[model samples]
Structure formats: C-alpha cells, structure tokens
Target: MIPQSHPKLHRSEFTLGVLAGGSGIRAGRRDKGLMIAKGRTLLERTLERYGKGFEEVVTCCRDNAWFYSRFSSRVLCDVEPGQGPLQGLSALLAATQTQYLAVIPCDQYSLPLDWFERLSSALSSTVIGVFATDGGTHTPCCVLHRDVHSQVNALLKQGKRSLMALYECEGLAHMAVPGAGMDIDHTDALHGVIRKPPQ
Candidate 1:
C-alpha cells in the first residue's frame, strides 16, 4: 500500500504470520480467536495489526479458515496439518519468500507495531531467531530469518514439532521485548492485561 491508502498500517519487509489455531482448552472451546474481547473479536484485531505491517499477512487458523476472508490478501491456511505452532511456523516459512519471517500468537491482548523492526535490527543474520525474553527465559513468541526453514523442515519431517526446539540452533538470538512476551492463555488470565482491541 502507498501508506496513504491505509495510514494506520506500517510497511515492513517481513511477512507477519499469526498462529491462531489449536483446540481452545483455555477459552472453553469457544474458538479463542473469535472469543469476544473488549468488544471486538481477537481475530479481527489481529488481522488489522498485521495488515499494516507486511505486504501480506498469513493466518494459520485451521478452524477459522474463512475468518480472514473479510480482510484482503495476506491470509492463507497452513499447508501442513495436525502440527502445533512450530509446524505452523515451518509451514509459513515454506510458503514465504521474504528474507525475514515473523511468527506471532494471535491471542495476545496487544502487540507493539515496531516489534518486527526492533527484532530485525538486533539480529545480524537469518541463522537465529530474535525472541522476547524475561528474567532469562526465552519467550517462544519471536521473529527469525528465513534461513531456518531447512532445519525446521527436517524437524517436522521426523514427526517432531515444538516451537522451542527451533531455537536450539547455533546462532539463535533470544532477546527480551519488555512486556511484549506476555500472552493471553485464558480469559481470566487476560482480565486486566490487554486493552479492548478494536473490532
């Protein structure tokens, strides 16, 4: 977009992949992304955030395949099935050609728009993923260079899937992003943390 077309959207070279699928044991099986938050559904607010970032936003929501149709391009189904967020990330890498890939959890109450730029500027190469950390624990919510696809594919090929394992690579950079690492795992847990996102 020419920025003027959508002044609220931020333009970036990275493709923002939002991971929104998985049985919602936390949200009581009511499709966590679609669960009413504040007033707007989490899904709606998430698409808007990413829509402003990359040229496109691809959502990996298995249950809500059509949920993103309301938005423009940038949303697509994950090519692989039954795999967790790691698999979803792997699938995302497989479909993208951008030099950088960002994986986001759609359940967050709010995320900073400058997130991709901050993480990208910190890491020098695609060999590592820039993760959000606190204390010293690596938060799986992160962004990585496109170069990890080969390693990620191999892991999925072996029937092994987990977001944390992808960071075991030699040059992975796990840095903390202040409060960006917090996630809304359950409604009660989300209670006073995130703002009422726009619908």
Candidate 2:
C-alpha cells in the first residue's frame, strides 16, 4: 500500500541515482542513456530533473568506460555482470556516501517533480524506504536505505538479479503516484514523449 503524505526530509542525507545499465534489447542494443530526444540525451534529460535536488547524482552502467569519458565523473560502472538492475543497484549503493538512495531509470523521464521529497519524508527506522508507483512495486523508481546494502550483496552472491527480488526484502514500503507509467522502453515509445525539433 502507498504510504500517506509525510513531512519533507533533508535532501543532503540522500543520494539520487539513475540506473542506466540496460543492454537495450528492446531498443536495438543502443544505450538508452545516449538516446536523443528534444536535442538532449536521455541521461542529460534525467539529470536535469533530479541532478541538482540531491546531495549527489550518480549513474550505474555496465562495462561502459566510454560513458565515463562522455559524461565525466559521477558515473559508476557495475562490478558484476549480467545481474541487471541488481548490479546497477549494487553499484549505486556502494558509490553512495549518503544514508539513503533514490533510484530512477534513465528512460523514466516523466516522474513527478516532487518524487524525491515525498519518498524522503516517508523513510524512518521501521520503514527503510518507499518506492514510488503502485502500478508495480518493483519498478526502478524507488528509494532505499544504505543499511540494506548488505542484503543486496547477499542476494547478488546468491545469483539473484532483479529489482523485484530486492523489493521483497523486509521493511520496504510503496508510494502510489498518479501518471507513473511513462517510461520509454522502445523506439516507438519515444514518439509519445519526445517533441519534434523546431521547424
């Protein structure tokens, strides 16, 4: 169930992370981060949304040293392979110096503007974190406490890779947001989101 509205929390205590590690199987193996829309890459667009709103902004990628050269700093490479978002989450969690992390997909550009504030306020000792979106509890849009890092590592060691699996951990909560399913997964999906270039 989605948690009730709570007071805003300090942004300095949480790290904002973007999971851009997709192999792009649905999008023809292209790096979704680099996909262009509205004269900007998806990663660029995502950063514009939450980059300045947190203590730090980091990107979790896979074997993409080129991405580092392209973006410079704040880009973290996945230590393990073939683990999907699990690997990205591990990388993000490890790189985060803050007590909490808020992760959103590179393709999920239309999230509520107040997402971080809402999720941050919902966290507490008993509630490790609250993931936004009631449509799917396992969607990449979620927040987590640094305390769960060990559990995530344990799951990784067990060869378990998938955000849905991570969500099953105890003490996590969910937040429902209206109009939450605007992620762009395929090429055609872009037409509905991206605007045409100036005439």
Q: What lDDT score belongs to each candidate, Candidate 1 first? A: 0.64, 0.73
Query: Candidate 2: how large is its RMSD?
Result: 4.7
Q: Name the 10 consecutive residues with the lowest summed lDDT in model 1.
A: 2-11
Tell me the tens digit of each residue's lDDT in model 2 across 56-114: 77778765657644653488876665568877888888888887888888777666677
Runs in model 2 lying further than 4 Å from the true structure: 1-7, 63-73, 195-199
Q: Pick the candidate with the highest TM-score.
A: 2
> How close is every model to the real structure, measured as TM-score?
0.79, 0.84
Residue 133 of model 1: what lDDT? 66
Candidate 1, residue 2: Cα displacement in angstroms equals: 37
Q: What is the lDDT, from 0 to 100, of the residue 199 in candidate 1?
A: 31
